[model samples]
Target: MNQQAISDLITKMADDELVLGHRNSEWTGLGPVMEEDIAFSSMAQDQIGHALALYRIQEEHMGGPDPDAFAFLRPAAEFKCCHLVEMPIGSYDFSLMRHFLFDHAEAVRYESLLQSEFAPLQQLARKLKGELKYHTLHADAWILQLGRAGGESYERMQAALDTCFPLACGIFEPGEADQALINDNIYPGEKVLYERWLDNIYRVLVKASLNMPDPAAITPAYGGRYGQHTPHLQPLLEEMGAVLRLDPAARW
Candidate 1:
């Protein structure tokens, strides 16, 4: 196995979870309802847990920094999360659509990793799939309800989907060592995952009476993998690390 390829892949995955987890956590006291507030809070914790586990693998197996320092101390440019995960949690429609699109991609990614030749990742994927199953279920149910409501609710969902589709495509942006990882059976590769994600989400969207935009009509939002981010990320990172940064020597 190419260590660098594996490490890079792990780092990117961890960063995505860390950033999106923080975004999800923002809904803790602010969800549309009590149930939703609790749900997002739960999912946010799961994402952060996933991030911690992945970072531990990197630190133990790839000689990366410990999870705390690596996650809280990295410069925005060093993060490898896709642009999709970095966008601000907008209105409920946007956040919900983002969850629907992003989690499906995540489901496919972890399903592919289940067979990874890398043992640590394979084990982690196994555990994560269980948590992600509920996430997809939640997203699917909400998307269906909103998309078929036949009024402003449906319109808002459709609009959100159109806005998010291109950004979601960025989730599958080819990583620097993606080909090598694919060749080594470390992963099935982004292109394969992207196709699977499209199929998976399409099945649900169709059932919801939603229309998918033409793939060719939308240019995939890209560049987050190469250190480019939306302006929203830095402030998020700063807020996420504020307490930790305040007293570098303080133990949590």
Candidate 2:
């Protein structure tokens, strides 16, 4: 990929990580129990830290904007995070479902990145992979714990998943130029990645005595990768961007 295209791709990915990481952090001290609270909070910290690292490279390549400003100043519509991450955290089940979905997706992403031709990106994957192992484990643990519950609890778990699965699926949406990146061998094949997602998730659900919702009945509320986001992002951006908007002319 050319400099501009590579910069744009990584910038978008970094921005997505930045926003979703912050959103997840909002759950700190609020998870169902101390273990979950700590687990999720730590994952959130890892995510935000990784985003900052990537954003620094984006800043160096793209020029002008610092990582913090780029993260905290963006308008709601400009962010590329999937709707799955921005959806409201209604209950423990909901948040856990979101975690399961994203962690699985990121597992695939980090694994693909581990094979990246770019030395910097490969090193990044190596560093982040350490934390991702726990992230995927924690998410799977909760999925098994909750998905195994009987009766009402089981249905509630399924209900939370039914709401988010479409958004989860959108995480794999391919941009038109993504193939070039794939062909260059800088990125992995989307179809193969997606198949892995399906096989892995199906195996998990079946093991947990759960069933995935029918695809024919599923439809995403928004496609944030394509710039369509939930109404929640507006208030989220306001809280995150308020100070940045005030001091756009000021240096910190």
Candidate 3:
């Protein structure tokens, strides 16, 4: 097996979860409703927990850095999360759209990982499948309700979807190690996952009366996977690492 390829793949997944987990946490006390607040909080916890697990796989099996340090100490340029997850949690509509898109992508990715040749990843995928099921359910339900509301709610959701679609596509930016991962049976590769993700999300979008932008016409926002990111990521990294920087020995 190509350990470097496997480690890079794991790092990308872990970084995505860690960054988005904190973004989701921003809604903890600020959700428009108590239920939403609680829901986001719970999902945030799940994402972070998932990140820790992936990081542990790297540390224990791949000879990677400490989970805490790797997650909190990495510079923005070293993080491998896609740009979609790096963007701020904008309005409720935007955030909801993003969550819908992102969770579904995650669902497909993990489902594919169920067949990974890597035993550790396959086991982790099995455990996370149940959690991701509920996450997608939550996102799907809200997207359907808001999309069918037939007023400002529906309009806003459509607009959010339009804006988020391109960003969501970034979730599948091809990795340098994709061919290696596929050859080794560690993953199915991003292109395959992207198609599956599109088919999966399209069903819900149709039911919601949402029009998905032509992916062929949209240029995905890439570069994050290659250590390049928007201006937003550095600030987020600083904020995320503030506590750790203040006390490097701090334990959560």
Judging by lDDT against the true structure, name the best candidate.
3
lDDT (Cα, tens digit) per residue for candidate 2, span 1-252 = 555555655765676576678778888988778887887788888888888888877766457378877788877777777777777667888888888878887788778878877656777889888788888788888788877888877898888878878988877767666777777676685566767887778788887777887766877444686677888887987887788788777886
Can you give the TM-score per candidate against the true fold?
0.98, 0.91, 0.98
Off by over 4 Å in 3: 250-252
Which pairs clash in the backbone of model 2? Answer: none
lDDT: worst 10-residue window of model 1: 243-252
Order the candidate numbers by lDDT, best to worst.
3, 1, 2
Give every collision pair in model 3: none
State which candidate, 1 or 2, has the greater lDDT.
1
> Alpha-carbon error at 216 in model 3, in Å?
0.6
Task: In candidate 1, list every pair of residues with a backbone clash.
Answer: none
* Candidate 1 stretches greater than 4 Å from native: none
Give per-residue CA lDDT, model 3, range 102-171, as digits (tens): 9999999999999999999999999999999999999999999998889899899999999999888988
Worst 10 residues of 3 by lDDT: 243-252
lDDT of 3 at 215: 92
